[model samples]
Target: MEDAEIIRLVLAGHHEQYAGLVQRYQEPLILFLRRILNSEEDSFDCAQEAFLAAYRNLNRYSKEYPFRAWLYAIARNKALDLMRKRHREVLSIPDETMVDQRPNPEEVVLAKEETALLSEVLHELPEQYGQALYLRYRQELSYKEIAMVLQVPVSSVKTYIHRGKEKLRQILERREIRGGKGQPIMEEIISR
Candidate 1:
């Protein structure tokens, strides 16, 4: 079912319909939170809080924006709040345990190596650029959706993404020259 129709049904007193939205977005939302929080438990908690907040504020949700973007904006706000309360910076890392379900052991090792390298490179970037790149490439959000989530203009989103990619490419190139065995993988990533 369409998100709009589900939302309409939910607002019209069929509160159970909200579960469908939750089911649809829960995993991706939690993954997004995890990247920001860097703690599995905290990410799950934040995801729940964000979902609750979204539900309560459903009436104020504008239809002009994509529902996924709106939900991500809520999630991002929740993550920022949690970080403020903790009074510390969160170091984002990809979960090592999360690997492709393919049975090949070699593929799993390559996946882990790639994830580690990407995370290390992202950490070196300015925080905002790292986040912009993550949202654009990792989450596959539209530029407009990323702008909404970041509370920035679409033009800013475009600039951030472009600059971020340029910076990432430079970092990868340096790694390729310094690292022998990882050169091919780094070059492939840079080519992408």
Candidate 2:
């Protein structure tokens, strides 16, 4: 059933209908929280909290936007709350399976080296840009959806994602030079 239909059913007193939505989004939401929180236990806890928050606030949901985007916003807020509360930084490598699963046969497979390089560069970026890029590419969310998740205007989302990609490209270019001289600079900045 479409999200709108399920939402209508849930709001109409068939609360059991909400389980389908939870089952559908929990895996992706947990993975997203894991990347942000870097702790498996915290991520799972936040995922549950996000779902509960969404359920409690479902009356405010609008079908004009995708339900997953709304769920993502709640999850993102939960992770940010934990970040502020815990004073933690450094994103652990996201699970190999965390990327979106929509089939696209022509997707280019990155070498292990390239994947590691990308992950490192992504983790190096400021949290805002990193999150915009992660939500865009990793979760395959649309620009509008990303705006919803980040609670920003669509233009800001565009600029953040554009700058994030440029920054990542610059980092990669620096690392591509001979003799591997980029390590010192990368380590210096990332160690903070």
Candidate 3:
């Protein structure tokens, strides 16, 4: 069923329909939360809280807005709340070795190393830029969708993406310089 239909059902007091919404968005929501929280446990908790909050506040959701975007806005707020409650503690990197579902060992190792490095760089970014990059690249959300989800103007979204990419390039260049490498892995990824 479409998200709007499901949401209509939810608003009509079919609370069970909320579970379908949760199931549909669980993975993406968890992945987004994991990127922000850097802890699987915390991400799971925050995702659940977000879903529950959305369910409780369903009546307030405007039908004009896309349901998924509204849902993510709730999730983002929940994540920010969690962060604030925790006094903005720095999240540690997830253990790359634990992600063992790889078909090729060599490729898995390379991917893990690259992921760790990229995660480090992403964490160093300002929150808005980091979120813009994550939403654009990781979630594969379009510029319009990201602006809606973030409740930002489309022009602001464009500016954020442009500035974020430039900042990311600078970070990669610095890494390459420190490592005595000519170009960073990001250059290769971008070129492709």
Candidate 4:
């Protein structure tokens, strides 16, 4: 079922139906939070809190907006709140790789290594740039959706995404030059 339908069911007094929304977004929400907190426990807690907040504020959810974007906005706020309380800069990509279910051994290892390098480069970017890249590419959110989540204007979201991609390109070029490596890992990372 669609999020709108699930939400309508919840708002119509089928409180148990809210679980559908939770199950739908649980993994991505937790993974996003984990990137911010770098702790599985903390990420889970934040995701839980975000879901609760969403439930409590369900009535305020506008049907005009995409449910996933709205949920991500809540999750982002919850993560920022937790970070403020903890006062830490421990954000790093979790050790998760998007490998195929059935993969060649050598290809899997290379993918893992490349992913690790890409993660480091991403984290090294300025927060806004990194976040823009993550939300735009990794999460596959549209500009309008990202604007909603980031509480920014659509123009700003576009600018951020463009700059983020350019910044990533520059970083990769610098690395390639410094390493003097013939590998096109940078292109692979960006093209992927």
Candidate 5:
């Protein structure tokens, strides 16, 4: 069923319907939280809190916006709150064991290196820009949806995404060169 339908059912007191929502969103929510919190345990805990908050505030959900976006907004807020309470910076390297599944050795090694670079660069970004970029590319949220989540104008979302992409490109280019690479052979793929 569509998320809207599921939400309607959930709000109507069909609590079982919430299970479907949770199943549908759990992975993305967890992954998003993981990127922000950099800890599997914390991500899972924040994801649960996000879902519970969403459920409790269901009456305020606007049907005009995508339900998934709304859920992500809640999740993002919870993750940010946790980060503040911990008094730590965002975008640290995640624990290796926290990965949901293992890749082949070669793939895992490459992924770990890339993730470390990305994390370092992401930590350098200002909070709003970092969050916007992560939400846009990693979580695959639309500009409109992101604007809604961040409580900002759509134009602001576009500006942040544009600037964030430029910064990320610079970071990647510097890393690639330092690692003894020339222009990305997969320039097309990277651009995409």
Candidate 6:
């Protein structure tokens, strides 16, 4: 069923139907929060709180906005609240170590290393830039949906993504130059 229809059912007092929404979004929501919070436990906690908040505020939900975007907005707020409490600024990428299902060990190792490098590079970016890039590329959220989640203008979202990609390219170039010499990317970034 469509999200709107499920929402209508939920609002019509079929509370058990709410589990479907949770199941559909649970993994994505947790992954999104994990990028921001950099802690699996915290992301899970924040996602749970966001869902509860969303349920309580379901009456305020409008059909005009996409349900995923709305849920992400709530999740973002919850993450921000947790950040304020913990005072953390560093963000990390999604964990990609689950390679047991893949066929080749060599490919899995290479992919894990690449993911680790990308995560390190992403951690060096400004929070907004990293988040905008993640939402656009990793989460596959549309520009408008990202704007809704970030509570920014769509133009700002576009600028962020463009600049983020440019910065990422530059970082990769620097890594390519210095990486062969055993210099850590963090040292390279810090020296600049």
Where does the lowest 10-residue lDDT sum fall in candidate 4?
177-186
Tens digit per residue, CA lDDT, model 5, 87-166: 98657635343462766776666656655656677677676777787777666789889997787999998888777767
Q: Which ten residues in a row have the lowest lDDT in candidate 3?
A: 177-186
State residue 109's C-alpha deviation in candidate 6, in Å: 1.0
- For TM-score, the strongest prediction is 1
Worst 10 residues of 1 by lDDT: 182-191
User: What would the TM-scores of all predictions be?
Assistant: 0.91, 0.81, 0.83, 0.88, 0.81, 0.89
Off by over 4 Å in 1: 96-99, 177-192
Q: Give the C-alpha miss distance for residue 121 in model 4, angstroms.
A: 0.6
Residue 22 shift from truth in candidate 3, angstroms: 0.6
**Candidate with the greatest lDDT versus the true structure:** 6
lDDT of 3 by residue, 83-124 (tens): 889887453334444646878887777667766876787777
Alpha-carbon lDDT, every model: 0.82, 0.77, 0.75, 0.79, 0.76, 0.83
- lDDT value for model 3: 0.75
What is the per-residue lDDT of model 4 for residues 93-161, given as tens digits with 9 covering 90 to 100?
665666356467776676677657767888878877777667776677888888888888889988887
Candidate 2 local lDDT, 1-192, one digit each (tens): 988899999999999999999999988788778778888899899999999999999999888889999999999888898888888775754655335374653332333343455567778777788888777766789889999999999999998977876776577667673225324323332332
Quick one: ranking by TM-score, best first?
1, 6, 4, 3, 5, 2
TM-score of 5: 0.81
Taking every candidate in turn, the Cα RMSD to the unseen true structure, in Å, is: 2.3, 6.9, 3.4, 2.9, 3.4, 5.2
How many residue pairs collide in each prediction? 0, 0, 0, 0, 0, 0
Candidate 1, 1-192: lDDT as tens digits: 999999999899999999999999998888788778898899899999988999999999999998899999999999999899999778586664474687888877777877787778888888778888888767889989999999999999888877777887888677664354644544443455
Q: Between candidates 1 and 3, which one is better according to TM-score?
A: 1
